[model samples]
Target: MQRFVHGFLLLPRCSLLALGGALDALDAANATLGHAQHSSLCLSLDGRPVRCSTGTKVQVDHGLADAPELQSLFILADLPLPDAARDGHARQLHPWLQERARYGMLLGGIGSGAAVLAQAGLLDGHRATLAWAQVPQLGDSHPAVLWSSRVYEIDRQRLSCGAGTASLDLLIAWLGRLHGERLAQALVGHFGLDRLRGADERQPSPVQARIGTGGAKLAEAVALMEANLGEPLPTEEIARLAGVSRRQLERLFKQHLDALPSRYYAELRLMRARRLLQQTGQSILQIGLACGFASGSHFSSAYRSRFGHTPREARSQRALAWRDEPDQPPSADSGRTESPP
Candidate 1:
């Protein structure tokens, strides 16, 4: 029987949900095939255990330098791109990854892993998708990459997907290509998924689902609010765009979201600002301005009230957490290896 090996390059602070979802899909595919048609190996930059964003430690089998030949490799990183501008190790990993790609291995990323690939210059001229929260920053940082809001994308040898269950979608599609549509269908059904979403399917924004189809006007207002994050539209203006009176808009929000329209809009803008703060290298002032705050102080105050921490505090905590991460060197290559039979 033909066999393939797929590598997962797990980064520090990767999303456990995304990693598990992708692995589960592959496991299902293998079970459906009744053999190890698709074998998987977890690797780190250095062959060591890496802690995920949720504090789960995963012991990897190989380091990048010692990785066995593989059909495809996925970079899995869920957090911010580890401030590559300041970290020398991060800088080095890029070229190392580029060399792997040059060797004709199918390169892919999960969640913010696309950000890492973009930083490595591997995603240039490639259409890719990332977690929705990271989309704006990745677009700004890597204009050469054709970034999409879709759940996942497969462009040539490059594959990418948003975080969480979207990883299942990406892997299932890949499994379909490798085995057959019949096995893929069986795997999806086994996972209890209602249906497999196509690559072209866009991820619905948070507000879109919160408002639901019953509240078309509310959804429209939310969409308008999202579009006007930089320059917030007045509630009256949002109501007008949604073809409803301000009172009706207010009623809809209170009924569905349990919040007033103005409050919901403010929260939305604040949430956008928080994501930019966490995901982008943008300055607090710039993020504040981008999120419709008049000044840094105003933004900080609002952010503190909403998130219970100042923007500087949030950023400082992230930096501290990164600094506290242990740097494990690559393990010496052991003769023991798992290859397809």
Candidate 2:
């Protein structure tokens, strides 16, 4: 049996928890197997120890250029991706990652690592999710990738998950798929997990904290805005539905969110419009109407004012840049069950 070689491509300020979880899971799985069938390595851009999220330095086994051919590789980064990873460093990563994909490598991303892959154009047309907070920004940017709010997504050979323990779930689930459920179950016991989570589960909403403290009336008004985004309700009607006067609504928003009710509401509509423009193949005019803009010019001006780009440019810029690679690996390596070593 071929040894299952896994590579972890670590970025600066990478999530220590995420990287540790995946490494420990692999270690435990190897221990349970009583064989060295599974192996892991850490890669860095320059083959040096990386200062991770908590300032702990993680040593690397290889630089990107010298990385050994592996069965799988995962890019792990911290949430709210730091600027350094996406700048000149990412330009170096893109072509190397593209080459790996060309030869049947299984790629995964944890936390904002998914964004890295999307930036490299590797996740285009592939369903993927990152930490939920990163989704909107990703929708506006790498709209070619089918971004989701789910805790994890496995589209064909590509794997991805939200930050933190979600990375554990992704690796463990993939372990089960590659080996057997018995091995996966043993690791769950080893780690004392509640239960193995599934692909459909969504990460906890990051907005819960704000909503909890924004007061009931404010939350109600926001809920109404969210539900009526396509056909937005007037602030007066929203206030009335929330059992508050329009004056009180304005006060509540200003107090908690620092934006007027109408301004907040318009921003929401525009955000939805931007997502539709980037994430879907919708016509610009149709998207404008759907997002409550009455005219193309109004939509264009609003979109440019908010996102600093027109809807056409937003769609055109994203131009399926990742489609250069074949969507699936050859049959020789794809979906073939490995004989246990």
In terms of lDDT, the best-performing candidate is 1
lDDT of 1 by residue, 250-310 (tens): 8999999999989988998898887877767788898899889999999999999999999
RMSD in order of candidates: 5.1, 9.3
Estimate candidate 1's RMSD in Å.
Answer: 5.1
Evaluate all candidate structures by whole-model CA lDDT and list the values in order.
0.82, 0.80
Candidate 1 Cα errors over 4 Å, as ranges = 83-89, 204-217, 231-245, 274-280, 283-285, 292-341
* Candidate 2 structure quality by residue, lDDT tens digits, 169-225: 988898888789998999899999988998887675634457575487887787678
For model 1, state the Cα shift of residue 6 in Å. Answer: 1.0
Worst 10 residues of 2 by lDDT: 332-341
Q: In candidate 2, which residue pairs get closer than 3 Å at backbone N, Cα or C atoms, i.e. clash?
A: none
Clashing pairs in 1: none
